[model samples]
Target chain A: MQKTTSSISNNISFTRGVPALEALPTTLFSECLQAVLAGPDGKTVLQYGHNGGYVPLKQLLAEQYHVDVDQVLIGNGSLHLQDMLTAQLVQTGDVVFTEQPSYDRAIKTFRRRGAKVIGIPLALDGVDITALEEALARYTPRFMYIVPDFQNPAGVTTSREKRQALAQLAEKHGFYLVEDVPYRTLRYSGKTLPLLRELNPERTITVSSYSKLISPGIRVGYLIGPRDIVKPLIALAEDTTLAPVLPTQAAVLEFHKRGYFERNLESLKQLYAPRLQAMISAIKTYLPGIDFAEPEGGFFVSITLPQESNYQHLLQRAKEQGLLLTDGNGFFADHLNAQANQAHTGDRFVRLPFCALTPQEIEAGMQRLAELVRA
Target chain B: MQKTTSSISNNISFTRGVPALEALPTTLFSECLQAVLAGPDGKTVLQYGHNGGYVPLKQLLAEQYHVDVDQVLIGNGSLHLQDMLTAQLVQTGDVVFTEQPSYDRAIKTFRRRGAKVIGIPLALDGVDITALEEALARYTPRFMYIVPDFQNPAGVTTSREKRQALAQLAEKHGFYLVEDVPYRTLRYSGKTLPLLRELNPERTITVSSYSKLISPGIRVGYLIGPRDIVKPLIALAEDTTLAPVLPTQAAVLEFHKRGYFERNLESLKQLYAPRLQAMISAIKTYLPGIDFAEPEGGFFVSITLPQESNYQHLLQRAKEQGLLLTDGNGFFADHLNAQANQAHTGDRFVRLPFCALTPQEIEAGMQRLAELVRA
Candidate 1:
């Protein structure tokens, strides 16, 4: 029975937001590692590096972002950079703002750092400006975290108009805008919108990572911001991790230098675009009772089940049928707080990640969910 | 004048605790990276990893330490593990105890977390037990941070008897012991002492890293503790960095599997022991008025200047003379707090790391220091 259950659980997984196995450039990465280690600066690469990170990687990122080298701080990963940002800025009783259905882990991190996270309801275009303005008027958040391009869980890209409003509001309110662009380059379709940082560079901090564009195992991520903000983060890195992992950073730099980065990103879009299409088709055919906005890019397609549907029950049944899913309740800050208070909210929502699974697997998984919903 | 100043600053540095460049297994590491990427699990290694860490490395460490695999949690680095631990247990106004001249970065980390840090005085043998006991009598700390083996900035090993006493004290007082062992495996001489974790498995968390043993640039470290503690740390890691860097962890595992870890450690001792000896010899010959406990192993030799010496002036003059010294004041938590309060203490002490410098460089640096002392 246990063996059968284990095998059943291996049937399909839509819970991961990682790149598909076919999308990872394993051989290219190995070559990049070799190229880096055989370079003239191999000895320096192997030694303890500067707290800011590998200088050349910082330089590369600085050039690309049109920022000074000092403005770029390479971290273990962008998530690590977010953790440091919270540590640097948040204190107990502080307020932070995020989209209503935001990335679960970022919400957890903010709350863990003792911030009362206020969620601004998200619209198809972006966060509802009216709701955000009302919250901003009532409380001054230390920072507002926005995943503007292909936002996680919701898969809704903030519109250019929303980005402009956010930039203006941030400037007027005097709160930092933390623009996390981890999925910016993963667009399968849709026109690129201006980044909040590009819109308001002075009050914005942009965080991104190679986890998707490059192999996640490389764990190279960076933050570009004002020099004053980047400086303390570097000091935090020094006291905490000493330095970012250099060999991997060197390998990433080598990969970029070899001009494989753009090509790999193009390949990733090609590989994932079909999977996203498969998910949309499956949802249309098999999940008629579900409501969702079709995403043009990124890994996730979030849906809201029928008002009468019991999502917790559906989730349990889906697991029994070997359809792995990311639970919807975790994506809301207020829902999490309600959970701790022995209440429940947002249980009818679900996020389906399409990048890590094949079209066939996605079809089968959605069919299983359809049967469970009908039953 | 700027170029001359830059050249002088580059002459001799004693501020770093990194391994000598010659000691790094650069070629071996590259081979291991290639080997791991060429292995059957290469695809999985490049994908997002399990939150606990790369599994085989944990298994290897578990077997070596005689603990269950669940008890071990690999981190970005040991300092990162320390950061997680402090975040998990420390609250604002919580008490944390450390050696009077503990690792300066650690003191900064704990203070940054809003812990009211109390420094236990140190003797040549370890933390002064009487001072620790007195502090314990007055307040309960969330945890006591100890670098038992050749403590950083002090180079004093805690005696086995003191380790036992600490274990007992922790059990009686009901506080955790965060036993950091970054320099534990880098011992160039002396008998290996029992780890505090071995003495009291229930209350002690052992944090060690491969930065010194393998290579600092790899940034692999781990913590072994009770399941409850390790579990939360893993969660924190998940919410923060997602997972530790996998390529480097896989390389470390491959390096171990290929049976190179021991030989590399042996080579590291051979490379560093002579440098330690040279520093000790120079201290005795050139700066006779300075008092110090000669360390048998680890990266540093800490010395106390004569009472009449103005260390701030000496540090400035040393910078001008092309001699770099780690300022002593940063090591003391009370001293740091005093500085914020417009007072200063612990300026008489200086920590000189010998591992990154050569015997010749150590000799020259010590001679420069001797000249400064005389002046």
Candidate 2:
């Protein structure tokens, strides 16, 4: 599948979850990297760093997350943290829960570890609480993986009520809530809800990365969890990558220290907000029959076609027109196994990412998509 | 154990395998990094990279190693590569064979994955062939993990004949040979030997990293193996860190393209050679009774105390006198489990690394170590 995607040329890709290339603060990031290389700790940055991460970076992250220093464990990226957490908690055949259309790579990670993943249907506002409770009661999974804020493919933020309910449920059921908040800070609109960690500190393990917020290529992220769980993870991390890349860590720390991180994030919001708005408007203008909830922030806008629409055929037609978007069937676990109702519903959905495309590109791409759908 | 080591300060550290800070080509590296940032592909460097790694870097490595690009998979570091390989190959309760005194961290990774590690004593040339054959006969391991080039903590490189024998044995026995050669490029003196992969490409997976040769903090490494073995590892890597840090990969690619890598490596060789020589000379002059095999290259020179000597007590005395080195016992898998003969023999060894310190520090530290051993 990746090979097929790579073979496509001269196509506008709405499938990737990356930040727009035009929007990346490359010049400023380079300056920060150069500053780190010229600094007093330059030599130290070239050596093997602490397994948990560079202390200064951890301290800065601690302040931002409003957590103690020990709570944070740095990784190559949030994906690496997810891998570590899965390795630590889930053994083969152990049940793990996730949203039906959660992040695909994460589902791959959990499945690779041989965890039996059960996906609960996601409501428009969040995870379906009743279904989640039923799954929890049935399987009692090792952890419930959730993307509360602008959940990846779904692009729906979990409501405040659902967040609290889920957190309370985790505590009540004695299962950990793995809150993946990579897109949390990218809120272009709407008031922020309380974090799962804030709701149930002891039972919640929050994972976030600099990939979406800073730069994906830097591959720096952190896991904030209980000390007992985090301690073993640090040891596992030592055995994994030994540590995160120190020069990148140093570069990010310098960027934050120079007060560029907040400013850069603000600039990103300005850059992406309108592109997202353009996508929403384009969807409404062209694809009249498509159903989608307007996403306030984050990368994706998922559109469900009419029941009669053949999404795979439409996708192929759109590809022929040189626009690449993700088929929603790939996002659902049950679709892979050909589960009847879930797979049927999955065939009607397609995810369009607004973050990596220009506003013009978004509009044109959507036009092409709508043309294919209409045909 | 990590905490205990971190607490000891104001001592000349002979335990670390990292390259000397004074010798890194920081200015040149910084320039290369900046060049990459300013280049046309700068935005691509900040975006998510391919799971296999940046293609140009892989091509460069492929040319250097005389392998196809698909044969190479870049990782966060060699340790990360090891973890990926382990996850791909080993299952819980699987047997894994290693040198009696192997790299402690790799051993930890294997053990943490629930592989029962069996240690075969290493001869002056390499792993004792007799023991290896006996172990193979007794149990079929998932893989034989070996650091053939300047084996960590032992500083012994395998002979060409021994390399061929191990590779042939692996093929004959129908098991894989995992050759870890992080220090392969750091040869200060010695004729190059045939790599394990060269002898038995079908049965050998060679893992090497830039950590020792270029910079550990950048955390770049590659695995060259059969495509079938590598394909699964690539999927596991995607599930692991998604990909290696892209900015560092770009920086390294730029450095290599600009021909700074070879120059920097030459500089490192020049810097480390004399320090290694100084340590050898100091050991002869100050610690007369100690036995050690002179290493032609790489970081460590392991010393074995006289049979009656209490190495742990001597280590404490050396620490008190401001010299810190790794206890060789930690390197042996049997030591952790209190296995008799191997554990007892491990107690008599200590490893001193010459790469991180200056010639003066090596001499002074060795002298202090000699004084403590004499007491």
Candidate 3:
């Protein structure tokens, strides 16, 4: 072949965990760059960024949280902060816990840091408090990781009482609560539960980012917690990307300050709500046996297919037909352990995201899955 | 202390890292957003970005080093990869050797993972090879990190012979060599030796990024090394930022493919060369007692003031006078250790940058420093 400039010099094999990007926010392509262009100095927002989060953006986030300037430490995304907090807080063989089938990315992060993670099952109103009490009583996790707002993988919301109960457990157990709440604002209905941090200032480290609200491409997010915990997280931030992309944060802050967040978020709701409904409809019409919870609001739905079905194989076939879904297995903390895999394994669940796709694409993708499963 | 909707909730104390806007190219930023505005399609570039590195950027980088594509794994940036690669290769008590006064942030990262770092003194020709050899014989670091190009703090390049010798020592000693060459391309005038990766193919990992070439806000960079190593690194990336910002990669790829990089670099030289000269000239005229090796190229100069000098106090004074310089102590991996303090410790060295500042600003900042130091 001719030496086109499109040279992938390295023989880069695929990672098993890359999410399908087809559903990503289309306008993010321009939004991140445009924000940087429009910032006060008209700088590219791409220099050796500040060790702290962007100044105005941090101020913007600071205003939202109603906290002092010292309480927040922004990161590349909530993901980076998640990894950093887990790294700083949990030690090898130390027991840490998260809501069952929660954001698997956080599980992977904590597990990779050598922490033995205990999963508390998710109930309708939040994590099973009874389960959390038992984990606290038995394992005495060093910290408990929670995604209180429309959590990932499970896509469940924790109730106000459950959130308070969890916070109390942290206080009683003397273990920190690591809250990953990137979806805190995407509420479609119901009053939002106060964040674990808001409920108990001393116990919870609340982390959130602009990915869900603005665009993930800019990779701007912040972690809020006690000053002690924030220090190492800041050091971790310094070590990681130094800081989140400045252009994105500057633009995001400007956007939020100018009341653009509401408009953008409204657009997001209009974009995702219909698509989510279409996916729900397709699942209903195509394969009614699949058990899944409808997210109050967020990017994904978790479905438990028939016990006899091989969801992993279906996942492969789905990809073959140009549909992409995150499989349930990789979300487990002990996935790498043969014993844990045997004990905690199930192939009945998969996560489908409709955020980046239009309603039609979601419908069509679900139809293809329906056809494949029937075949 | 208004309960404003604009700020983050917590009274977060930490400062945000600087945004990337102050240093990136503008035209490319707009083009990048245009790509994002285009939706991800079945065959769209956004499906899943390449696992290791972007194809064209990697190829461009690989060709520069004369390495095959199998040798690279791209990630968020050299910073993220540094953490990931260290976490993969390093363990508790593993010895990590860095320059005597090196990138303190990187040093802090390895330490967080419990790596025991031994600093080797830096000289005009790069790391003090003799001292390095002695340290290698003593500690046998899991990896030796060197900025072979315009290094972070010192702005020194290793001699060609030293590069070969260092690579040979890696093979002889059976340890990996990580040549962080971010500033390799940003040269003002001096000759650059062949990168350590080129010196020893099997034992070297070359990490580079567009932070210098284009922008840091895009947060795009790649690591090149053996595929076996590349695999684990990507797995680590799975836990890292998931993937580099997708839109940033697309923007950069478009720019690079359309020959934006070459033109930009050419223009950057024009923008930076005079400033660098102006900085060096000011350093000579004002801070006569403080001496440093003139950087043939790159953004920083490691200037050594007297040990008795109070650099922090000086910095505060400079700031009051509208000038800022990074404290030299942050470059040490063993800042906590009193022994690591022996290597150019305290008010001795300051990393001064002329790349982003104008000739006037450089002159002004240096004049301020001179005044503060003299007082």
Candidate 4:
């Protein structure tokens, strides 16, 4: 598989959940880097920074999020914060809850920290509340992780009513809620809802990043939470990396200060919204009757295959046709209490990320996928 | 103490172990960032990079170290790699060993991971071989961490003979050695010794960073080791941060490719060498008969206070004289096997880092210390 995959050339990949290359503001980044290097705090950017983050960026994020400076802690990436949180809270045999078909790396991170992950199935609007309540009654999770806005892979955004219920559930269960909102600002059509932290400040830790908005290469993400959690995480980060990268953080701050983020984000939406529309229309035209909710915003659109269809065969065939698709099994989690392995949880699904592809490319890829499914 | 320390407007201190601001090549960094942004791989620099590292930088390091590229793994900083290694290997009740006066953060990181850290006392040349051997005989440690080149807080470089012996002992006892060499290239005098990895590549995991030579703010460090260790670390990094910061990594690669690193290293040595000289000379002139070692290179010069003198009192007095100093006790590890706490192990020592201060400031600081000691 590795050999065959590597041998293929000129392939169109839907595996990446990254912004388009054309969407990156290279000139703006260069200008930001230059400005930051020439700025008053130039030397500070080249030296070891505060363990929690670059201070100016923290202040900026604090103001933007309406939190005190002490409540905001920055990291290398949002996943870095998630990994640290898992390390701090979860131990061997501890239970963690995630949305079914969640981000695979988060699942792997929690499991690596020796936690048993039980993924609750997600409805079109949000994570299934009934299944979540049943799980809550059975096990007390250290934390529940969710990408509330434009959830990854599944492309499901939680409704306002579900968000309120989830917040109340967290309060009753006494478990922390990790509200990851990497795709919050990228909404193209849907109205924005209140953040989970706003609904339940006591039990919510909000994680967001400049990756989706500014650039992923800068590697700046932040966690706004209670000081008790933030302080220990600061110590952990200090022990690990001493501090996050400051030069890029300063560059990001300069970009934000120059009001480039808003403009860049607007251009990004313009660049991506049409592609999303193309993907949905292509799915309808090529793979009619496929079960997948249309995402209002975000990078992905996952479709469930018929029960008899094997995802691996489809993936390999797609690769042969120079169309790369992400396997869905990786997104699902093993049950904590199951005596036997649940091997087919996400095997009958496939994820296609629309952000990195053009409308034409998305159409072509879907056409190729439909041919494989019909075969 | 916090209020008084914060209230002071002016202070001459030896607490920080970072490069002098004057030595930072801000202009060169700007040029490098600009060049990288305009280079052929410009778009790649703004996207999520390989979990292992930016490929060109890894290739450059691999070529420099005379190893395959796969053996090299870049990290946020060298300390990030060290912390990950500790997490992977040192489980609860695990025994780890370090020099008596080790880097404070490394000690804290190991202790936080639930490892019992045994401090091996250091002689002038290096760590006490006799003590290390005795500890090895009693407890098989997960790994022995050493600064090897310019030991942190103590500034003791290992002799060639001691390096060979340590390498041999690692092989004989079947224990790994983590040779951290952040200050390897900052030598003002004395010939360079073979790296521990050079002596025993099989048992040595080398961790070095660009923090000292290039800039800490870029946060690029690397590990060169066997595939087994490097492979798992790459997975862990992916699970955590997805990738290291690609923009900074590309900037560093450009810096290295353009030969700015060599010029920067030369300037840094010129900037820091005189300060080290001043610190050594001041110790002899102002604090005559003080027990200390004259380091050939590196950032620090530590002196042992007389047994009757309390370090807390000296620290307080030093602060009153508008001076800041690091508490030495933080560098010493608590014994895993001892029945009682080792309260006074490093209390009789104070570490002075010369890199951040000017020659004149070093003399002034030493004068103030001498006055406080006499009073």
Q: Which ten residues in a row have the lowest lDDT in candidate 2 chain B?
A: B1-10
Q: Second chain of candidate 2: TM-score?
A: 0.93
Error of 4 at B243 (Å): 0.7
Q: Alpha carbon lDDT of residue A141, candidate 2?
A: 86
- DockQ, candidate 4, comes to 0.78
Model 3, A1-375: lDDT tens digits are 122212322212111322234334455435544655755544636665664677666676678788776778876677777887877887789998877776777877888878988777666567778766766677788888887776776667778888889888888889898888777677766677788888888988888877667655556768888888886667667666664566556766666656767877777666667766877787787678655666777766666666455455866776666656666666555444313433234355566766666555555666666666663
Docking class of 3: acceptable
lDDT of 4 by residue, A1-375 (tens): 012323434678989799898888889989999999988888889988885998888998889888888888889999888888888898889999998878988898899888999988888899889989998999989999998888888888999999999999999999999999999999999799999999998899999898888788878888999889988888877777897788888888889889998899999999999999999998898877777779999888888776555455777888788988777777888643221324225656688899988787787777777767773
Cand 1, B chain, TM: 0.94
lDDT of 2 by residue, B197-296 (tens): 8898899999988888778888888899998998888877876787668888878888888888889889888888998899889878877766566888
Minimal lDDT window, size 10, model 4 chain A: A335-344
What residue runs in model 2 are displaced by over 4 Å at the alpha carbon?
A1-10, A312-317, A335-344, B1-9, B312-317, B335-344
Structural RMSD, model 3: 8.5
lDDT of each: 0.84, 0.82, 0.69, 0.84
> In model 3 chain A, which range of ten residues has the least summed lDDT?
A8-17
Give the poorly placed runs of model 1, Cα more than 4 Å off.
A1-10, A310-312, A336-345, B1-10, B310-312, B336-345
lDDT string for model 2 (A7-49, tens) is: 4346877787888887777898999989988988788888888
Could you give candidate 1's per-residue lDDT for residues B345-366 as a string of tens digits?
Answer: 4676778999988777787787
Task: Please say which candidate is ahead in TM-score: 1 or 3.
Answer: 1
Per-candidate DockQ versus the true complex? Answer: 0.72, 0.73, 0.34, 0.78
**Candidate 1's residue-wise lDDT over A244-309, tens digit each?**
799889889988988899889889888999999999998998877555768888888887777555
Badly placed stretches (over 4 Å) of model 3 are: A1-32, A184-194, A212-214, A254-261, A278-294, A305-327, A331-345, A350-375, B1-24, B35-50, B257-260, B278-292, B303-347, B356-375
Categorize the docking of model 2.
medium
